[model samples]
Target chain A: MDLSLSTRNVSGPGGDRTVVEVGGEIDVYTAPKLREQLVELVNDGSYHLVVDMEGVDFLDSTGLGVLVGGLKRVRAHEGSLRLVCNQERILKIFRITRLTKVFPIHTTVDEAVAATD
Target chain B: MATVELRFSAQPEHVRTARLVAAAVARRAGVDEAVLDEVRLAVGEACSRAVGLHRSHGITAPVKVVLTEEEKNFSIEVGDGVTGTGGGAGNGGDAASGGSDGASSGDLYEGDAEGEDEMGLAVISGLVDDVEVTTGDDGGVIRMSWPTTPAVTMP
Candidate 1:
């Protein structure tokens, strides 16, 4: 299916960061898209990505891989990637995988962006 | 913009393939990064559920996935046999209570409180905004819809 993806730029205490708003279910099928976007952003010299998952309804291992992979890529370039997830289901995955400690997770995009700065 | 339909064998490997195709389609459609990840998660859960159901019943037909991108909704339809309805409640244990907490220890069917770690219909229902299950003369179909506008780059 055509999963809806929304993108915006947010500026705050964290300086300038790209906020990627995800609204839909994420799985192995769609993880590549996110990976590609992260790669492109890295190539363009844009780091500090904040993925807003408040609107996301679902996420799987492959989806988790994409996030972890992005974190690795961003860190390699001396950049950082954070997540803003509110859904219990999505958050549960992060908490279970102990990935919450890996990436800086915030309650909202504002908090994540602010923290990045 | 356009819809992509794919039919694949009822195997774990094909499920991965479906996710790959779905991701490619979403990227070509200009979907953002985080959003695309969710789509993949949902699709994987759905396909895995279908595989488990089919395996239980011994049906050897390719599972069909129709990925359609409408004006304001992105929808996925995954179907199996004429009556792929049962086994819905088995996974409901995970929903009623988030008990497991995410511990993938050995096989889930052993002695876990929240049944097994079978992430299928329950996972999809948890992730998607709207889930429609239809059973009739045709067959059983699961339709998942997400209400959000895609990030389309215009020329």
Candidate 2:
């Protein structure tokens, strides 16, 4: 079975930050893909990222770990990683884990990309 | 009262199906719609943890899931078939000393899988209001339950 997670870079090369659009369920089965993408972007010097999760239908602890790991990777380079998500269910997981304090979540991609460190 | 039993190979991909079925059953059991997402996520975490344990022990047995709808509650039991996995705590540290299957994949994971395993359990506990974890020689079982309204008869 194909893992339901999908990710795409929506931003062009010249922007100060890269916007990655992610959709589908983020779970143990597909979180590796997100982790790989994040690692590659950080390696490629795209430190600042805005992950647009508006299309995500579900997310679990493993997916949260990947996001937290990504945040750590970017922070190592003195950069930040923000998320654009408004889904109550999706946001609940962050609140449950108290990770809302770690990730800067916004309703719009523009808001995530515009926020200062 | 109603009961549904599902068994599948210890694989990550199968976790999604388990969650879907659990939520549908929970809804039919008169669980609140707003809390359906919690049910789905909790089931996913429990099933995923079972699959991980089976894989870590090199066990070929499938993971077992049981959904029970009572008069005022919905419960899910996610059980693993890994026997003698040692480490009653199910931590990565003691998995290597388990039994025959212990050495199968221990070297590859070292302790990373254990960390994820702990985190998965933590997430499960957070999502479930009434949850229980028990580990013994027979293996481990995570039994989680949520309150429901009056049972709705199925069509």
Candidate 3:
């Protein structure tokens, strides 16, 4: 039950953004870990955040809730939230939830990073 | 085709571990990842319901999970001993509320985010192709089934 989380610092469209990449499953059990990280980043005034989920194996509604909650938190601070997901299943989830419009989705981390600036 | 059976404590921590093991095994069996994940989620949700039921009834025991993988489909059965009681119905929420045991459904869904998390069961029901609950002499069983086919229906 180990989830691998990776982070990257990029300078892009907006200015400086932190890309937090998540791999493995994001279910009811492990989603809190991601939430904690997102909250910390937001607290540190990391306004623009991109979550790379291409390597994510699964995502439950709880996971989706965390994303929605994080997006709301960032937007409240006049920041933005985006996603990098190439997996068709994961992509379909965002599409099904109509979250594709709510968040900027990119095919690559590079693209997601680029869009942040 | 092979069958797998796993029994573990009903504690929340154990439930998560059991689910991860089930998903990993299913993936190794060549099941599609989405389907595997669907099964895992269903099994986990069902187990959560069972734990809630146990707390209501003042009974504590390990939940048993039985998984059967066929060429065309796979099925999982979650069982807890409480036969001839208010279980096996399609709706576990009702069973927990009946208060036949010491705890009431109200208690199960009472004031916490766990109740919100309980919604996972609804998601599970929607994901799996088939679901059944059987109450018999030994206990109550919740079984979920899915086709081997990939679950992502492109829209």
DockQ scores of all models, one per candidate: 0.05, 0.23, 0.05
Q: What is the lDDT of residue A22 in candidate 2?
A: 86
Candidate 1 docking classification? incorrect
C-alpha DockQ for predicted model 2: 0.23
lDDT of 3 by residue, B35-130 (tens): 765667677767766665666666677788887877777777888766755443344333223322322222343324454344444455455658
Model 2: per-residue Cα lDDT over A1-117, one tens digit each: 333434445443434778888888889888888888889999998888899998888898778778877877787798788899999999987765556766789999877766775
- Candidate 2: deviation at residue B152, Å? 6.9
Instruction: State candidate 3's DockQ.
Output: 0.05
Candidate 1, A29-109: lDDT as tens digits: 465677778788878877778888887766765566567667666677777788888777678666544456566788977
Q: What is the full ranking by lDDT, best candidate first?
A: 2, 3, 1
Q: Return the top candidate by lDDT.
A: 2
What tens digits encode model 1's per-residue C-alpha lDDT throughout B24-141? 7766555566667666766776776666556666889878888887767677888776383544533543532342332232123222212322334445555556777666555567
The residue-by-residue lDDT of candidate 2 on B10-101, one tens digit each, is 98989999998999999988889988998999899888888888998888989989999887788998888866543233342232222123
* Model 1 interface Cα RMSD in Å: 8.5
True interface contacts retained by model 2:
0.29
TM-score of each model, paired residue for residue: 0.50, 0.83, 0.65
